[model samples]
Structures are given as structure tokens and as C-alpha cells.
Target: MEYKWIALSNTTIGVLMAAINGTIIIISLPAIFRGIDINPLTSFQYLLWILMGYNIVTATLLVSFGRLSDIYGRVRLYNLGFLIFTIGSILLFLTPNTGDLGAIELISFRIVQGIGGAFLFANSAAIITDAFPAKERGKALGINQIAALAGSLIGLILGGILSVYYWRYVFLVSVPVGIFGTAWSYLKLKELGLRSKGEGIDWAGNTAFGLGLILLLIGVTYGLMPYGSSQTGWTDPYVMASMISGAALLVSFVFIERKVKYPMFRLELFKNRMFAAGNIASLLRSFAYGGLMIMIVIFLQGIWLPLHGYSYSETPFWAGVYTIPLMLGFVAMGPISGWLSDKYGSRFLATLGMVIVGIGFLLLTTLPYNFNYTEFALMLFFMGLGNGMFASPNTASIMNSVPAKYRGTASGMRSTLQNAGQTASIALFFTIVILSLESSLPTALATAVTNAGAPQLVPLVHNVPVTGALFAAFLGYDPVKALLANVPSNLIPATAIHIMEQRTWFPTAIAPAFMGALRNAFYIGGIMTFIAAIASALRGKRVIAEEKEEKEVIKNA
Candidate 1:
């Protein structure tokens, strides 16, 4: 009944919806391709766009929208986000075309949803900070962060379930939730946060920042696809130009922000130790763990599940089911960590979390492809616990360190870093995997094909594009089937064809190579997380600017 609780619940719903949409498409990509009558192998561009467009749009807009919310009202912008997200969901569910047109429509609509998500993510923490007292913000944000994690967790399972019936159901599920959140936010939420009156929009800074990030993320997205003779497009001229131009523009944005009268990004805020270190640590942690779930999913759906007798189509669902320990660990520790941070400072608790995560990553590197389920589950739970411990307190420290008037901008800056780190993390992870694969995959494939009684086809399968293989694994496709699609069956023996097509053969063959690459990724991730732990430790002490401001208000009164 209280205003604070009202604000918390509404923002939680908004975050939950946004986070759910963020991940729902990943597990359901195969079904979505089927629904639109598109072949993913030939249309890899569409797949990349569908997967990365939403996040690209969201990351690009957060700082601008957050600044807008500061100039206008956080509550007003948040309500608009809800409405737009709902509209995007509706359009996605009612997609009218098939083939390339349908895929294009889906990507465009998801961008619309990303725009809406930007608004919600940019303002939710600011709104919560506004409504709750300083002492209670950690606990409040902890619950909010839990909603985000839970939504992601639920989306995986939900996408698996919904895709079994219809791909449209994946999008349809969000419609009702979006409608409810939109109506509730518009009617019940109030403008509790301060608005920086008369501040003009810094269009120059925004344009530079937005365009810069867009180009950079686009480069990263395309860098995953095959180009010319390379397994990845990192060396493509266009990719290189885009990345160079993006970095240049971002540098220009920094200069433009410094000169502007009312800059959208308040860079000066980073001077505070808590703000700077917290954000840096947050970015590092995100970079370390962002692609972790997908990596695990690929392991499960591509190698582990299939070798264990699960069909390719069945792997997606069971993969989601098996990873339940990850969500459970986060759910168990999130609130407790928040409460602890509120009593003691974030420095110790948050740093310790990243250390634990680093340990988990190290533990994962030891796992063989045929790892025991108990060991795998325990590792997942351990990492989840570490992430849960770090997320809430780190967020709380960032929000609390800023002045009240700039909370929206601060929140936006924080979200932008976090999102950008995640995008970069995915790029980094794929690059490492693809490169590792290139060195050994050809030899492994040739050997496997020869052993499978298809020595004649070994040349064809030997130079298989690593990206396609990774995507097939990710989507739970039979890699052998896709590879042998155009090969004349008459040339190969029927017995050999049957052997190669067996669910276990391809998985078992690829497992050794894939697992080796995966271990390299884990080692890199562990090192990054340990660096994040050092950053978290360097955050010094917690500083709640609100408490200082409150005392000043009392003194004036």
C-alpha cells in the first residue's frame, strides 16, 4: 500500500519483462527459424541480427534516455517504455510474413522492444533510489536484481516449453505481462525523483555516443560470422572500418561531453571512488560472465545431452532443466548478500564474490566433456552464488554514490557499461572459441569422417566453417546432417550414412575439440573475474550521498 513498495513492485515487473525478452529468443531460435520458414545455415546474417539487435539498441539508448528522464521525469519515461515494449511484443507475436521478410520484421520489432527496455533499465534503479531511504536501497535493489535474474532463468525454460508448441507462443507470453506493467506503471507510479529543470538536450554528445556504440556493437556482431577464408570476420575490411570509426567517435564523444553545457553523461561523477571502482568492477564482472550461460548451454545441447542419448530437438529443453541449479543459487544468495551489504560496506562482500566466481571458473576448466552431473551442477551453483553476491551490492554502491539529481544519468551510465561489457564479452568468447577451433577442427573432422567410413567426404567436411558448427551446436542441430546436405548419398554406403547420422557420433567426435576450446575460454574468464575482484576491493568504502543530503536539508530546515 505504501508508495515505496508500489514503486518497487512496478519496477520489478518492468525489469522482469525486459530481462525475459532479452533471453527468450536464444533457446527458441531454432523454432523461430522454423516458424518463419528460413534456413539458418543460409541466413546467418538474420540470426546474428535477431540475437544482437535488441541489446545493441538497448545499450545505445540507455544513457540518452536516462539523461532525458533526468530532464523530464523518470516515471514518465518509464511508463512510455512499458507501452513501447508491449507494442513490440504484440507485433512480434502477430508477425505476418515468412522467410527473409519475417526474419527482418522480427529483428525490427525486437529493436523497438530494445528501445523500450532502454528506458526501463535506465530509470528503474533511479526510481527505486528515489522512493526508498538510503538505508533500505540495497535490499530494495536486491529484490529488483532478483527479478531480472529470475526472469532470465524463467525465459530459458519458458522458451523451451513454448517453442515446443509454437514459436509465436514465445513472443505471445510477454504480451499480457507487458500490458499489465504498462497500465500499472502509468496509473500508480509517481514522479518521486528530482528532475534537472531547464537542462537542454545535448544532441551532439548523444549523437556521437549513440552512433559510436551502434557501430562498435555492429562490428562485434558481424565479427562472429564467417568472412572470406577466415572462420571469423575479425579481419574483414568493413568490420575493421566500423570498429575503428566507432572507437574514434567514442573518443570524440568524451571531448564533446566535456564542452557541452548540460552534458547527457555526467563524467565528473566518476571522480568519486565508489562510483568509478564500482562501475569498473561491474563492467569487468559482466565481461567475465556475460556469455557464460550461452557457453554452458552449447556444451549441454551440443555435446553432453546428445552423447547421453537425448535427441537434438530434446537437448534444448533438458539443457534448460539441468541448469536450474544456477538460478537456485542466485535466488538463495541474492537477498542475503543485499542485507549484509546494507549493514556492512560492499567492499568486502562484493570482492569476495568475484573471488568465488573466479574459483568456479577455474573449477570448470577441470571438467572433462563427459563430466559427472553432480560436479557440473555444483560448479554452476557455485558461480551463481558468486554472481548473486556481487550483483546487488555492486549496483547499490553505484547508485548510492551519486547525487540525487543525477541518479537517472548515473543509472544509465552504469547500465550502458554493463551492457557494453556483455556485448564485448560475447564477441571475445566467440573469437577465442573460433580461433581455437580453426587450429584443430580440420584435423579432428578429417579423422572422425574417415573413422565413420566416409573418407571420401573427409575433404568436404574437413574445411567446415567453425562459425556454422558453433551455431549448429547452439541451436541443437545435427551438424553432420547439415554438413552432408548436398553430398550425393549414392556415393556413400547406407551403413556409413546411418552411422554418421547417429545422435552420438557427431557430438562425441566434436566434443574433444570443442571442450578444449571451451576450457581456454574458462581460463580467460577466470582471469578477468579475478581482475574484477581486485577492482571491487579497491572501491574503498561505501558512501551514501543521500544521507549527507538529508542532513543538509534538515540543517537548512
Candidate 2:
């Protein structure tokens, strides 16, 4: 009994850290760029690696490590994750070099942190479910989900504070937490769950899956970059080739899995409709989720908050502050939804939540280019409400359905799908924004800079790459403002400086173009969430999968 609590506490801490760091880098981008002393306009790839590296590493390694946990021991592997994550944090704090190299090194270390995060996320839920009984599992999972949800937002706030004083402090904050978690988990975590052995390492399946997924993800990654005059690079020769090759490999890997004696992914799991349907729903929801966070941050930092009079420097911190509506909504309903799900089943709540989320997106679309606070806050609140309803229950359903022996792999598979979906969403959204910025950003920047009195620098302004948008976003700074700052003071009004620095100027300058891009992105987001709702609704009632006569009858044939 005590062990269950201990397990819950430790897993919660690890997951909390993992979830927080997932986004901690976003709001801290400005500080990071300044610390490293690189012009973000020229540092597009670095920005992508820094932002996407953690996600990509976690997504790629989750399933493999999950399988390893099943064979070795969840507790042993989980504790190792703590140590690795801590070490990564330390290395990040002591990052060497300067400029692009330093940025690259920091990103490299972050990838290591992501690897450790994969270990924690892949097995945390399964470990908790293993410790607790069925009745308590829903409640337990709810708490875990709450920590995850809260931790994400908390990262925004923490990053804002820590980045203000010292950019490295953001990384440093995790060190103490990681050290405690590592030692505590090592001393206290005890694995009592089913552990599979002698699977003899499915090398063929592992290699095929790893290579196939990497190729596919890389295709997705490059697809988001610019491709000569196109807003997006989906048609890039390289991206297209990668996608085609990755698909072929994945298809071949599926065949190899069936023939292998010990396949990492048991193809048979799909035979269970609930598991398959739940995963589909989970993936759909995650797609929207991954994109939504970035969009919301953009809205707040780049558009709304800034328009309302927040400077770029202060935008990151206030962005976190303003997002409290969502946080409040999630906290209020997280446990309640879990309790409701336990009593009434997950399908209704999850589907209903998706409906609410879709509606929230619709409401957001209706807001004028300039909207009032009440409307914005209310919309965000509803968005939070819908998310709160879905996240906890959906997670519980997925975990509860898996058999004990396969929990590690199943959890890993689930996390992989979710994390992968997150990565894909980011790529997709960036593609939309980057494509939009590619054309409008340069034109707008020249006029904006010229208007600010640096007509001589117009050529240089025009030369700034679209990737500048990404760097500006990561740093929580406005690209327009950065461009305008380059204007020679002698050529423009002194007020030009003040106006360019004004919160509303940048958002207003980029408003029409950003709106053009954001509208399409928001619609896509709504559609994704709506599809998830439909998937959720179709999941129907919950019935545990045990190999009973009816199940066997269905399975044997």
C-alpha cells in the first residue's frame, strides 16, 4: 500500500519534470538566443533542432526503451532515466563555446534530456497501474494526468522567471529536482509488475521500426522547411523522397514483424478493437494538442498580449500569466472527469470533451483580429475544459485495457504515438506559418524597417530569411521589431524607435498576414479535434479484454 503511494509520488515527479521541460525552452528562447549570441535570422536549423530535438528523440526512443523495460525491469530503467536526465541538465548548464556551436551543443544536450524523458514517460503510468488496484487506477491516473497538464503550463511560468535572470537557470532548476528524484526512485521504487524475459531481442523488428520511423519523421521534419518559393516544402525533392522511402520501409517492416519470432510490436494487439480505437482517438487528439500549444503561445506572445501593450521581453512571462484560464479550467475538472469516467465510462466524456474543444476552436475563429479580454478568456476557458475532460479519461482507458505483461511496451507505444503526433503537429503548424511568413514577412519587414527610418538597410532587411520567424517565436520576440531595430536612427523619427518597440506595433504590422495563416491553421486544428471527437464517440463502452470464450472465438478464427 505504501509502495503504491511512493510509486505514485515518484512517477508523478519524474513525469512532471519531463512534461515541464518539454515546453520550458519555448518561453526561454529569447534568453537562450542572447546567451548564445547568434542572429536567429541565420539560425533557422538550430532553432528547429532546439525545439524539435527533444520531441523527436523522445518520440523515436519511447517504444524501444519501453520494450527494454519489459525485459529488464521498469524500476531499474526508470531510475536510470532520472540520472541521465540530471546529467543532461548539468551539461546544459555548463554549455561551452558561443554562437551556433554553443546553440548546437545546448540542443544536443537537450536531446539527451529528451532521451531520459522518454524513459520516464514510457513507463510511469504502467508502474503506477501496477502498484494500484483496478478501482483506484482511474483516480491514480487522473492525478498523474493533472501533474502532466499542470506541469506543462508551469514550465511556461518557470521559464519566464528563470530566463529573465539567467538563461542557464532554466536548465539549472531541473538539476536539484532530478537529483532528488533519482536518489528517491533508486532507494524507494520497487517493481512488482509482470516482467517478460527471454524475448531474445527482436533485432529485425527493432531495426526496421527504428529506421522506418526515423526516415518518416525526417521527411515530416524537412517537409516543414522552405523549398524554393513554396510556403512549405512538402513538395521538396528530398522530403518527397524521404517520405516515399520511409513508407516503403515501414510497410516492409510490418511484414518482417509478422515473420519474426519475437516482434517488438505484437501485431495482434490491433485485433482488440478497443485498444486500436483508443489509440486512433489518442493520436487524433494529440495532433491537435501538439499544434494547439504552439498556436496559443503565438497568439498570446506574438499577437494578443503584445497588441494589448506587453513588450517582447515581458511577453513570455505574461503569456504564461494570461494562459491561466486554461490552467484553471484543467485543474478544476481533471479529477472530476476522472471520477465521472470511472462511473459512467470514458467514451461519453471523451467524445463530449472533443465536441467542446471543437466548439472552442470555432469560437476562437469568430474573434475579430482585435478582440476583448472577456471573449478571449472565455474561449480559452472552454478550451481548457474540453482538454481537461479528455486527457485523464482517455489515458486511463488506454492503460487499463493493456495486459500486465505488455504494459511497458504498450505504454511506450502510446507515448510514442502521442509524442510523434506532437512532433508532426509542430511540423505542420510551422509549415503553415513559415510558408506564410516566407512571402509576407520580407515585404512587411522592408516597409516596416523603412517606415522606422532605415531605408538604407531595406536590402538587408529583405534578405532576412523566413527562419527568422522561428527564432523570433522561440525567443518570444517579434521579428518585425528585430528588423526595425537595425534601421539607422538618423533616417527616422525618434518616435520610430518607440513605436517599433511598442507592443501593438509588431502584432498590428504582422496581423493581416498572420491572420491569413492562422485562420487556415485554426480550421485544420478544429477538424483534427472534431475527428478525434468522432473517434472518441465511436469507442463505445468499456469492457476489459480477457481471453474469454467470446474473445477466443473472435481471435481463433
TM-score against truth, every candidate: 0.98, 0.92
Best-matching candidate per lDDT: 1
Instruction: In model 1, state the lDDT of residue 182.
Output: 95
Worst 10 residues of 2 by lDDT: 541-550
| Cα-based lDDT for every prediction | 0.92, 0.81
Cα lDDT tens digits for candidate 1, 1-557? 99999999999999999998988898999999999999897899999899889989999999999999999999999999999999999999999999989999999999999999999999999999999987788888989998998898788899999999999999999999999999999999999888899989999999999999999999999999899998999899999999999999999999999999999999999899999999999999989998898889988999999989999888888888899898888888888888898989789889999999999999999999999999999999998899889999999999999999899999999999999999889888888999999978888888888898889988797779988898898897888889888899999988889889988888888889999999999999999999999999999878999777889899999
TM-score, prediction 1: 0.98
For every candidate in turn, the CA RMSD to the true structure comes to 1.2, 3.1
lDDT, candidate 2, 93-123, per-residue tens = 9998889789889988998898899899989
lDDT (Cα) of model 2 = 0.81
**392 Cα displacement, candidate 1 (Å):** 0.4
Model 2: how far residue 201 lies from native, Å: 1.3
Assess the local accuracy of residue 246 in candidate 1 as a C-alpha lDDT between 0 and 100: 98
Alpha carbon lDDT of residue 165, candidate 1?
98
